[model samples]
Target chain A: MIKKLRIMIGTNKKNILALTFIFSSLLVLASTQFPPWDVPVEANDLENPITVDKKNLDAGKAFFDLSCKACHGATGLGDGAVPSGDFTTKAFTGQTDGAIFWKIQQGRGLMPSFKAVQETSLWQAITYIRTLAAPQEIVAMKNATIVIEFDESNSKKLITAKVYETLENGEQAPAKEVKVNFFIKRYFADMLIGGSNNYTDDNGSVSISFPEGVPGKEGKLQVMAKLDDSGFNPAGLTEEVAWGVEKAAYWNDDRQLWKNNDFVPLWLLISFFGVIGGILIAILYVLLQVVKIRKLGVGR
Target chain B: MSAETTDIQKTGRSLKEITSDLLNPIRSKKSSVSLWTMLLVFIIIIGVYAYIYQTMTGLGVTAMRDYTSWGMYIGHFVFLVAVSLVGSLVTAILKLLEIKWAAPITRIAEIIAVAAVALAAITIVLDMGRPDRVLNIFLHGRIQSPIVWDVTVVNMYLLISVILLYLPMIPDIAIMRDTLTDRPKWQRKMYKVLALNWRGTDEQWRLLKRSIRIMLIVIMPVAFAIHTVTSWLFAVNSRAGWDSTIFGPYFVAGAFMVGAAAVIAAMYIFWATKPAYKKYITSKHFDMMGRLLVLTGLVYLYFNVNEYLVPGFKMQKLDGQHLMDLFVGHEAPLFWATQIGGLILPVFLLCFKKFRKPLPIFIISIFVIFFAWTKRLLIVIPTLLTPTFPIQNVPESWHHYIPTYYEIAITSMTVALVLLIITWFTKYFPIIPIWEMAKENGHDNPHEKVVLDDIEKD
Candidate 1:
């Protein structure tokens, strides 16, 4: 039997094994990232003024009682159980009634639509937003520091922060110093200033400030925090916060979260085809060798 | 080709005298066109002109659409690639094993491989959306795409096939250059270019053998890549039926099956035309090719079982409908016919000793090649038509891709073009490698006596 055996092979078992290993590794690498099911968030300026109808206002109150009040608190102050945004802050005034109206209609990040909240109730909710205090009036006399905060509504890490002088053109140039406070459901750590720590007001309020000589100081300043799409528009959603620096500007380094938008969802299709194409070629090469061996036969 | 040599020997007049007498007739153009030859050539020309019209209008003239970007053209290319796979069996496979019977059929198989692969590459280009930017495939190629891999592998296969064809032709070309003292001056010049300064020295002979051995070694992998890449072009896509793990082997087996069929078909054409080749090609050659076909068919059948039956076993929501479309559904007629007529029937027919006869094998091969081409079309188009997205479109035809007249014409052109290339080469060079043939016959010709005596010892 040994004397009669004839072998004419293109690839040995080892070579085929090596090729298979390589393709397997490529498949793993190609499919490492799972396709995203996350929604997207975009800049929306949808504003529509409303008539001062008491019925709509009452409906808005009912709607607000159902959704917004739990976080905003009954007084529209940052006194909710979670110490959510103080609707009655200096930040509140800069946003026009239209902006507020838009916010109520579209619902900001972490918030669901009021579209089903009743057509009249949506306008009513805007009427209530008007009563909230502007950030300028949100001064805490005890610590005498204006506070600005931005973070994820439903579990997201803080991103980046910067303070800047407010300009007439709405550009906020970076300031000399910047700081932010922390409050996780009343577990307040008074304040975390620029590389330092200080306590907030007795009622638990931390203050933020922009140093003097910051370029655009005159008109208005802002502190903004970028929020990723979380707990809301699962498909297309993001959260942002902006406040005047003279009044304590802050920004969340949430660039990563908003950038979640940049990741395309259609990439899964590409990888699926990629793996298929790879295996076919690998097997073809292997089988061709087999065919060669088979054709040559055992006995010449 | 030995039968022609015997015709003169019955009289024992002298082959040398006959050769001298035939020389004038060969050079002079006596205009011998049989009716059948005329008809075949006429059809070939029609296919050529139709293809020309398609090339001018661009792939848009085809029935393909954005969703079904690969329709009949890919279908044809896949079939061609499959058909080319038979070359490995006759050439690399047989030569490696030192099989004596591999000699007569090897050149025929190799020619088919070269022609089919050459045409396959052209068909793929014709299917491209931007054929002019084909260079972009190299410049900005993402190895991620199967298309890029295909471009690399097919080009490599093309190179290997040419080398395989050329190496065996060196001595033959030398003979064409030096032998037959009364041959035309232009014929001698053609032989000189083909010979490339072959003085047939020991060193030259060693170099030729070494190069051929290297190519034979290299060609198996290249051949595999050509068809696998062709299969991957579909396997990689996320379509219903096309998304299969077994597709690579499935395609390889299919390629071998069809390629063997192509070889059989070509053998018959030679049998009917040359009479000389029929003597050497022999019924035994057909029997062997048929056995090889049976093997390929069985392997393809096994793959089909895995490709279809295993998926059917799962009956996953998607796989169920996809298989049904071919099994007992809308494409039932075409799908089953292609699978049965193209694959299963050929396997069954090739199993018997009687059915493996040259004429029967030839008939089976024709059926196999034609059905295999349609099978590829069935594999690609149906899966594409039913994408993940609901089918809503600008035109009804877009929803149901049907190749236009131009597509069919262009496709036919590629076929005709392949034949045209083969015809041109055969008009000059021997279709059966003369040197290899002469060696098998012990170089009885007086001109080769010294060369054969020197080389035959090895």
Candidate 2:
């Protein structure tokens, strides 16, 4: 009967072990299955306006190195720290430029939205991503200049920048289709102020509304406009504006609990030293009594 | 006092017999004792080797990483600190309460306390990755830190415990110096110097008693402070398991329970190994200790209920996760085992008279002590696992804590060192106070009486 019971117990143990193994495997499979990201139909139908060239590809590569390389891998093989989807796959290359642009513009889960990135830069990044699947050749551009002007009318703050190109005979003409990005100069990186889709019109001028509530040092903000088109040399113009709230410096050096040891609260110090001193004195008295006991023993 | 004195005198042996019986363990050398000592020394040597390797390599050798940084070493430190409280419990608190039965076991408790606390100090150093730069704590020490307070109180308690152990042993040392003439010259001289020329004169007795009375009172707060400050090391943190106002009292109560179990375990060992110890440390002592364990166990149980149930009921997000881990998650088995086997069952079993017998209670005490160590680990590690922020960016192995062999070796070394110190003390000094036992048998000055008896014999 004991041997029969032992055999039954062994079978039960095996069954339980098998069940646990199967359950853990199922859990792992379920965790790896992520939901599919949905993109709007209109965003998928949008067309890429920027030309795929060496200059634009380099600019795209710079942005990809800064943000996407950490999660998407250096060569886009999905071998990065977080292990993203392989960009070199036919599944990835099969997607339309418009679909990829929408995915980048509207990220899901671990992917972050690139909505704040300038439209030209986003298109340039897409151009560089094409090379991750297969390498491409280089190209060059001509030089151009930009001039900026600020206007405050009907309580609306506006900034306009005019783009022009110099001909070989020294004649100047409007530089149409040039991308002009408006920014506020701040510590670290420049804060992008206008919408991402700013482009020069037939008159070679683009106007953008300056945003409200920008914090500046003593109400002075350096507004800058730059022409960073792949077809021309980059040029910039800066103008100081008082359309910012004055940033106040805050300082606190009070003697509080969180302060350093030099500024320890008085009550804590008193209580700490008071209690420690009282106990030490009593211990000292006890030690002194031991000495007296030794003396008494010796006197005898 | 007179009635009790007469009662004890009925079954009491002569003062001379009392002295010899209590001191016999020191005089006789047993092979088993030597074997035990050798075993402890061997383990300590392994621990030292592991520690050297750890220092040469780095803490990377241990499983401690970004998370679960405080592992078995800190847990062992808490255990030592907890066990060390038995010193103040039996030696000071019982002595102050005028509990006469505790006199024989005071030395045992004091020895355990001294060894445990001393090793506790050492264990903290072992936990440090840079054991060499330990002086940075002193060189740049700030009074605002709980660590500084812990250092201060632990050192003070060590000093007071040593004095408490020494002051009571003076009369015994003097007896050893005069009577143990066949002992090695260095041993005799060592006793002579330590005895401080203790002649058991009325004046010397007066000074000795006065000093002991002062220490017995003084040690209470320092003892409380040591463990309370130690508790603050955890309670001061805002972690779910450790963040509680009652942790100070909770820890103190638990310390008392664990310390009581340690004393019983030691009592049984002495009673079993040294046949002479059976005469002095009887079943009656075990029975009393069992009752004390029941009392401390109940108090600790009360704190444990408050510590867990209140938080468990509310089940705040982080606290809920932490409590669930302890109650039904990965840690539940060890947690339940500690609560039931270590605590609830022992407390319940010890209440009955049959289980309070030497053999049964000794077994129970062993379970209690073992669980108590694991209980400390539970208190430390589980809360760390349920950190406020999710554990990310590290390897999956870093999520859990399983102590490496090197860590285990170092921790075992601390335990072995405590046992070795206790064993060495038992080998040299009387495990029970010779003079105190004689005094209980109605001799006013047992030390002088032994000298007089010697002169008469000569």
TM-score of chain B of each: 0.87, 0.96
Candidate 1 error regions (>4 Å): A1-300, B1-59, B180-185, B444-458
TM-score of 2: 0.68
Clashing residue pairs in all predictions, respectively, total: 36, 0
Off by over 4 Å in 2: A1-253, B1-11, B29-33, B445-458
lDDT of 2 by residue, B1-458 (tens): 23433454576766567777887876775535477888898778767766875776577667776678888988888889999999999999999999999999999999999999999999999999899999988787677788988988888899889999999899889888877888878889999889887787777777788889888888898889899999999999999899999999999999999999999999999899888778789889999999999999999999999999999999999999999999999999999999999999999999899999999999999999999999999998988888889986455567899887778878988999999999888878998998888877666533444443542354
True contacts kept of each: 0.00, 0.44
TM-score of 1: 0.57
> lDDT of each prediction vs. the true structure?
0.61, 0.83
Residues A72-126, candidate 2: write the lDDT tens digits.
Answer: 8877887665537788899898877788999887766446677778888888888
Q: Write the per-residue lDDT of candidate 1 for residues A1-300, one digit (tens) a residue.
A: 222111112221223243333432333233232343222233234444566543444445556666777667866785553334567666665555555555555543223345445545666676655544531232211111222445444444232333343444766443322223222111232222233332333333334343332222342323322111111111111222322232224433333322222332345335545544564554455435433433332332
Candidate 2 contains a number of clashing pairs equal to 0
Over B1-458, each residue of candidate 1 has an lDDT whose tens digit, in order, gives: 24434453454423333222222223335446646446556555555544443444455456676678778888888888887777776799889899887786787788878888888888877777567888878786654566776877776677678768877776766655565335667777877666666665444555566667766777887788778878888887766788888888889888888888887888888777665566567899889889988898899899988888887999877767777877887788988888889888888988899998878889999999899888888888888877777764233456667676556656766776666666656655666665555555544343443442333322
List RMSD in Å for every model shown.
Answer: 20.0, 12.6
Q: How far does residue A29 in candidate 1 sit from its true spot (Å)?
A: 52
How far does residue B4 in candidate 1 sit from its true spot (Å)?
A: 22
